[model samples]
Target: MAELRGTNPYHIKPPEPKVLPKNYTQGVDNLSSEDFLKIYIETLRYQDPFQPQDLSKMLEDMTRLNQIRYMNDMKSFMEGLKGWFNQITLLSSLSLIDKEFVFSTNKIDTLKGGQYYLLSSEDIKGATIRIMDGDDVIKEYQVDINKGLNPIELSDLPKGHYSVQILKNGMPVDSLNLGVMGKIKSVSVSGGELLFELENGELVSPSRLIYAGGM
Candidate 1:
C-alpha cells in the first residue's frame, strides 16, 4: 500500500459567479423614447435638492438615444432593399427556365428545330465537326470553322440532345457540347448561388446567358 504524498480535504477555491448584464427597463413594453422620459422624470423627482443635476448630460443621453434609433431604422431599411434585390434576381433566373438559351456549349439541343448555331471559341479552319453519340462518331461535317457563330440549317434535325466533337487535322482537339435552343429544365439555389439545370443535365449560371426565344 503506497502512502499519498500530499492530500487536502478542503483546500479548493470556490469559483466566482458570472454576472449578467442588467436590463434597465426590464419588462416594460414602452419604446426607448418613453423609457428614457420615464427614467428622466424619476431622476428629477429624487435627485439632490441643493446640488443641481447636469442638464447637459441628460440632453446628451437623449441625443444618443435618437442616434441609436435612427441607425436601427436605417439598418432595417437596407435589409429590406437587399431582400427586394434578391427577389428580382430570383425572378430573372426563373424566367430562364422558360426561354430558349443560346450559349457556347458542346451539348446541342433543338427544342423547336428550325436552325441551330454552332459557335467556336478558337479561330481554326478545316476543323471537322463530328456529331458523336457517346464515344462513337455518328456523322461528320466539313465546314470552315470560324471564331464566331456558324449556323447549321436544322431543317429536319430531330428535337433531341446531341454532342459535337471538333477535330483538327484528323486529330481530336476539342470536344464541346453543341449549342442548345431549349428551355432550361429547372432553376434552383445551391450553396447560396442560383443554378439553372438544363435539359442536357447541365448546370449554368444565369448571368452568362444569351437568350433566343425560339429555334
Candidate 2:
C-alpha cells in the first residue's frame, strides 16, 4: 500500500461555474411581423427606465425584418404564378393529342414510303430533288415546281430514314424547305421539359412544330 500525501488547497483549484449566454430571442427565427412587434412592445414595457434600450437600432432592425418578410412573400407569390403558367401550358398542349402537327426538318423516316411536300417561292423548272441515303444518292428526280406546295411521291423508295434536298442548276435552292407531317399520340413532361410523342413513336419538341390542326 502506498502512503497518501496531503493535497495542497491552492494547487487543486475548484472549477468555475459554467456561464451560458442568455438568448432572449431564442427560437424566434420564424416569427412574423406582428409577433415581432408584440415582443418589441413587451420588451419596451419591461426594460429598466434608467438604462433605456437603443430606440434607433431597434427601429432599424424592425425595418430590416419587414423588408425580409416582404421579399419572402413576393418570392412565394412568383413561384406560385410560375406553377400556374406551367399548368396552363400543359393543359393547352394536351389539346394537341390525336391532332395532326407539321414540323420543319430536312429528314424523313418511313416504314412504308409516304407522300411529302415541297414548298417553292417561285416557279422552278427542272429543279432536281435528291433523296440521300448517307453520302450516297439513292434516287433523283428532275421536276418542275409551282410557287406553292408541290407534292412528291416517295412511295417508290425503300423503308428507312433519308435526307431530302432540292437543287437548281446543281446549286442548292435557298427558298425551298421541307415539312414532315405526323399525328400527335401523346404529350408529356420530363425534367421540366415538354415533349410530344408522335404516331411513329418519335419524341419531338413543340418549338419545332410549325402547324397543328385536325387531320
Candidate 3:
C-alpha cells in the first residue's frame, strides 16, 4: 500500500506423515486359511473397479501364510520328541538302583587277627559266608540269617590279611578285605546304624563285616 515493489509473503511448511509400527492388527490366529482365502476373493470382487489391489502384494501375503503353517507343524513334532527322550532316561536310572552289589576295602593293615560283625537287611536271603587268604580258600560257613540284623562268628582262623565274601544262592553278593590285627576303638552310629571303629582309625559297618570272632 505504501508503494512497495514486489513484496514477498511468508511460506508455511506441511507437517510430516506419521509412521506406525508393523503388526498393528490383533487376533490374527483367530482367522483360518479358508477365511483368508474368502476375504481375498471378496476384496477382488468388490474393490474399486478402476483402482484394484496389486497382484504382487496379494501373492506375497499368501506366501507368508504358508510359511507360518509349516513352522507350527515343526514345533509340535519337536515337543513330542523331547517328552519321549525324558521317559527313556528315567527308566535307565531306575534299573541301576535295583541291582544287588557288594562293598569292599583295599587298605590291609597286616593285622594277625580281630573280631568283626556282618550286618545285612532282613530281606537278604540264602546268605553264605566265606573267608579267603589271597586267592586261597581258608574257610566257608553257611549262615541262617533272619530279617533285620544277623551275626556270624569266625574264630580259630590264622589270618594275616583275609577277604570276607558274602554269597546268596551260590552267587557272590558282597566282600571286604580286613587290615592288620587291631583292637576296637569305639562304636558309632551313621545313617541310623552302628559302625565299628578299629584302633587303626578305620570305620566299618556291620553290613560290611561277614564274620566276628575272638571278641
lDDT of 1 by residue, 28-95 (tens): 32356777688778889988989868867876666677667657666776666555555456665665
Task: Note the residue pairs that clash in candidate 1.
Answer: 105-177, 106-176, 106-177, 106-178, 107-177, 107-178
Report the C-alpha displacement of residue 207, candidate 3, in angstroms.
Answer: 15
User: What are the per-residue Cα lDDT tens digits for candidate 2 across 76-163?
Assistant: 7666655555555666777688887676777766763445677667999999998999988978989998876676768578889898
Residue 19's lDDT within candidate 2 is 36
Q: lDDT for model 2, please.
A: 0.73
lDDT of 3 at 80: 55
Q: What is the lDDT of residue 114 in candidate 3?
A: 39
Q: Estimated TM-score per prediction?
A: 0.42, 0.58, 0.32
Which parts of model 3 are misplaced by more than 4 Å? 1-112, 175-215
lDDT value, residue 162 of candidate 1: 68
Candidate 3 local lDDT, 24-76, one digit each (tens) = 33324446779878988998898898898786776567668756765766666
Model 1 TM-score is: 0.42
Model 2 — TM-score against the truth?
0.58
Q: Which ten residues in a row have the lowest lDDT in candidate 1?
A: 7-16
